[model samples]
Target: MTPIARTRARAVETLSLDATATRNALSSALVSGLADALTDCGKDPEVRAVVLTHTGTTFCAGADLRDPPAPEALVDLLRQIIELPKPVIARVTGHVRAGGLGLLAACDLAAASREATFAFTEVRIGVAPAVISLCVVPRTDPRALARYYLTGERLDPAEAVRLGLLTTTAEDVDEALSPILDGLRRSSPQALAETKRLLTAKVLETFDRDAADLTALSARLFSSAQAREGMTAFLERRDAAWVV
Candidate 1:
């Protein structure tokens, strides 16, 4: 399969981020491919819901900064997911970081495996979760987001659920998700679409209002001297300059 591909089962569309090589980082191609796939699913009458998932152990590791980071695309992708007429469910069975957290926040519902872990790791690399904050800030616990975003603290599943980042956590992802899917299947597609618009209106407003400024904030941080040192140290497997 391609880096991002869509398949269907029982009126549900599964959008799989299949690039395990980079821990399914949001490369430009992968992000665009996913947006396009979601658009296609929205237009298909047979697709009642969407399941956003990954094929490997790490659901997503965040931006692929090997190239100059273009965070505008990630902002757009999160907007797309949040505003999509069909309900999107994040099925996280592994680790998620940085921008990946935005994807979960934008989804209408999300479930993670008990073994899955998460972190807002951008601060450690000297950037903030500026762009993703449009979605995450609203869905996340203020105290939790404040602590984790600043400290880059990793949260286990229960903490994640308590932090309002996940709907449920279980050892069995399929079991955790079965009821949601069944309920989604029982709903009328039109009602689901309209309800999604109602649910997401404020988040979409947040995106439209704050995206450009946040993108600029993220871009500036990525290009900063501190971020340069931090990223370089991370790549070299050494402590960052500020680690003292």
Candidate 2:
């Protein structure tokens, strides 16, 4: 119930994911608050950029398995970030998995430390990355995405950059991002909005066209008995029946 995120000064809004209780899992509050914060950023004339970061060691552990997030909630949040007139940057400093990858993909830019890890882990949980695919598919490398999207294997930040998931990977995240933020700060708000619209036009189209079907698929998969077993096993720290 703690605040999911907040915005700070410097024409920069830092949305901190404060759900350390669940390893910063994407809960209802986190998802809805993200959407609301992004909307606020777009409306605030003083806010030119937003930074998405988390307090926990884990950047985002994906859905709150005990009370999984609705596909619609995630879908809307991703859309809001993509369509936001202002720039959104992801300051990744820890592990990211499942739906978290989607949030990373929605960002206009991302900076991560060299040690962070990432994974597309839905397949292991008897589900698919249906809702998240809208953003993830555009940024992720095809061949690598093909493998990781299916295998649920983990990748290092360097590999993630090679796969186009991260914009910059450095030993120090702030060192990597300071220049990018400065350059963004120099641009006018109107130019940023227009340029972002130009850049995200196709992504927006795909989301409008496919979000419904994708969300439906995600919902169906999560509701299945097999997925229930997988989630239960995951929470209990055991392998699901399907795991060989």
Candidate 3:
């Protein structure tokens, strides 16, 4: 089955990750498909905003380690989402872990269900957050990220919202998304586009200067045996024993 699914309603383009069995693991096909969808949305004058969601109870579990894409490709996929012109909203439910959290973070805005949970579990998985870090570090509060990223702890919906990881929490997915859709509908398309561009430009400006710092940090983290052991332990359903 395809990992990513795409549909459109009015001016909203909805992309659902369909690989529910593996918890919608981010495969190359899924990343490429999403990239194509964003590209299509960019060219299609009718699509004003995009809603990113997933089917079933889980939002996304992270990359399919069994069939992972190259690191560069993964980074490129995230970059595409970040640079997409239209406002993208992540409609999250259940667990948003690792790269899944990254995808949500890349969206222009995010709304999650009350039952949702979030984590940066990469350290537990024997790897650094890497690509996902780029998306999340920009959107999340520095203090919150320090706690979660360092400890690899999961946050509940309320804490996620408090940490600036979520824009709103709804009783259900539909409930959470309704107002966002309405707001998008009320907005001027041209103005929305311009607003998105300006916000992205401003964000880029801030991060560009810090690229070297981020790169060095990521390298140090990724190269550690602790990162590898943590990732392996998590995947194997065992507790990690990494010392700081």
139, model 3: CA deviation in Å? 2.0
Clashing pairs in 2: none
Per-residue alpha-carbon lDDT of candidate 3 for residues 112-198, written as tens digits (9 for 90 to 100) = 888888888776666667766676777778987899988789899889888888898878868768877999888998898888877
Report lDDT (CA) for all predictions. 0.89, 0.89, 0.79
TM-score for candidate 3, please give it: 0.88
Worst 10 residues of 3 by lDDT: 202-211
Report the Cα lDDT for candidate 2.
0.89
- Alpha-carbon deviation at 241 in model 1, angstroms: 0.7
Which regions of candidate 3 deviate over 4 angstroms? 206-228, 241-244
Off by over 4 Å in 1: none
Model 2 shows how many backbone clashes? 0
Q: Give the TM-score of candidate 2.
A: 0.97
Q: Write the per-residue lDDT of candidate 1 for residues 114-223, one digit (tens) a residue.
A: 88999998988899999989999888789877999999989998999999999999999889899999999999999999999988888888988999899999989998
